[model samples]
Target chain A: MATVRIVITLKPGVLDAQGQAVHQGLRALGYETVSGVRVGKCIEITVPDQTARDDIDAMCERFLANPLIEEWRIERDQDRDGTGRSRVPVLPRSQGS
Target chain B: MMRFGIVIFPASNCDRDCVHVLRTVLGHDVEEVWHEAGSLDGVDAVVLPGGFAYGDYLRAGAVAARAPVMTAVRAFARAGGPVLGVCNGFQILLEAGLLPGAMLRNDVLRFRCTTVHVRVESTQTPFTRSLRDGQVLRMPIAHGEGNYFAPGAMLAAIEEAGQVVFRYCDAQGRVLPDANPNGSIRNVAGVCNPAGNVVGLMPHPERASEELLGSDDGRLLFESAVMWLETRKRSLVTPLRGSR
Candidate 1:
């Protein structure tokens, strides 16, 4: 089985109200280094065998994220060892990569 | 007679509200179209009602925008048919590319449900034909993601083209930051396509169409659409000069 990971974030110039609130909260808690913040979502899915990158891209475009305000990037977890090592992110679609 | 079609997607809680407004209050024929259906039948106007379509899962209106019924809705809009998208419907229209710009989370970061004052920015569109410029109306808005955003160039173009239909304003029709319920750029509450056939707004006009419910200003929008359709039909039947 292979694991698929997707990250979704709002496009630039779009307001991130929740992120701003979190940043304010962090600042209120005396985290002086917190300059700015933008909130995003990470989704993970498990699929059998090597799934086509185009299929995942279509899923993201059609259902996973809204292209008008949000953009999504997909990555596969190729190094899922028993030790729970860090997984490297790969670009499923070369969008300005 | 005007026939209105209210699209019903999974988890669309506001479909019946629109149906009631169109059928019971307005005395027009209304149809409840399922999201999976591919045809709109013979409805004169299509309305994308409010509520969390497809449970608003991945993104608000993202899943529902790709439903089979939307294809037909797009086709209808392309042919200059009138389409009104309210609240979640507006977000769906934005995602579907039928309208420009996108809706973002409210700057206050909360689900705001209250009666707001909006001024008629343009009176030429089918949705606002009955209204006059600067006319203040009380309408109800209920949504979490109602902040309208567009790129600078596109925003300027929309303003220049008179596509802005309604703008959040004070009771005296003054545009101010505090009057804006959401953080929409330029306080835009509703906008129409360049051709003025498709309109998308974050307010629940259907919910405000009756006097007993508080305000009936929303009825003017429906009346405007009906008037435009009737005028269009008349013009089609009798073309002015030379053509015949």
Candidate 2:
């Protein structure tokens, strides 16, 4: 099973200081195909099935993302047993390269 | 005779200011405690002064918050001791997991250096014993990452719990829309834990402790903390009102 999510950002705050310059360049080139733009960062994580939510949360706070400006969400892979309900599957799923 | 400890780190630049305020203005023998080790041998309260610890190389206060002495500081604060963190110190407190919310780059994307008025929100908390509701004080704020952020539910909960300590304001003490340099939510400049033992702010209160230096309004914060220590640590030191 695979749990998929997307975390997107434009690097850090200072990374986009040239935003205005780029926007102006686009206008001068006759592209006229751009509007307001901002940036952020993105990350993808896979956690263990036995891992507690609190432990994973702590890991996120300490390492995966900068606590100051980064925001993230977690989604667990669900596998159905041919039933009407969905249940989280075991993580670290076996996959072949 | 309350002994206070002013926490010092490699990038802490305001330790002396805190010491001067504690000893000269608030009348306490303030000790400079280093972060490389834990030895708060004789201290009633811990003050984390403002500075760019670790050059804020990572997140502001992220690296310094994990220093050895923070263990003891955390233990002490958890056991109902008072801990005050100003500016970079505030960043440390948040990174140390002592306080909620996080600070990011100022919304305006610039380092702000200016003096602003603030209104004291609560005098009942130990950290605000010397202040009254709506009392205004002018304090200096200098920071690049002072925008405070938390989720909506948590923000409401913090407000409902009376944790707000100060806000950017006009001369009349009304929070000014134009005065919010960082576009901080709700014009918040400072806040305390629900228990009121841990405080964090973006301004330099100790720098305003003396009339000769500049404004003396910030002295009230040191006074309030000292008063709180006297009331809470009666076993360690006898209380004094002004002088004999």
Fnat of all models, as shown: 0.71, 0.10
For candidate 1, give the lDDT.
Answer: 0.87
Identify the CAPRI category of the predicted complex in candidate 1: medium
User: Model 2 residue A62 lDDT?
Assistant: 83
* Residue B237's lDDT in candidate 1: 24
Q: Write the per-residue lDDT of candidate 1 for residues B25-126, one digit (tens) a residue.
A: 989999899999999879999999999999988778988999999999999988778899999999889888888887888999888999999999987677
* CAPRI classification of candidate 2: incorrect
Which predicted model would earn the best DockQ?
1
Tens-digit per-residue lDDT, B80-193, candidate 2: 677889999999998887887777677766689989888887665556777889999988999888887765777788788777788888889888888787776788888877
lDDT value, residue B168 of candidate 1: 95
Fill in the DockQ of model 1.
0.52
The ten-residue window of minimal lDDT in model 2 chain A covers A1-10
The per-model lDDT (C-alpha) reads 0.87, 0.75
Candidate 1 residue spans exceeding 4 A from truth:
A24-35, A45-63, A79-85, A88-97, B236-244
Tell how far residue A22 is off in model 2, in angstroms.
9.2
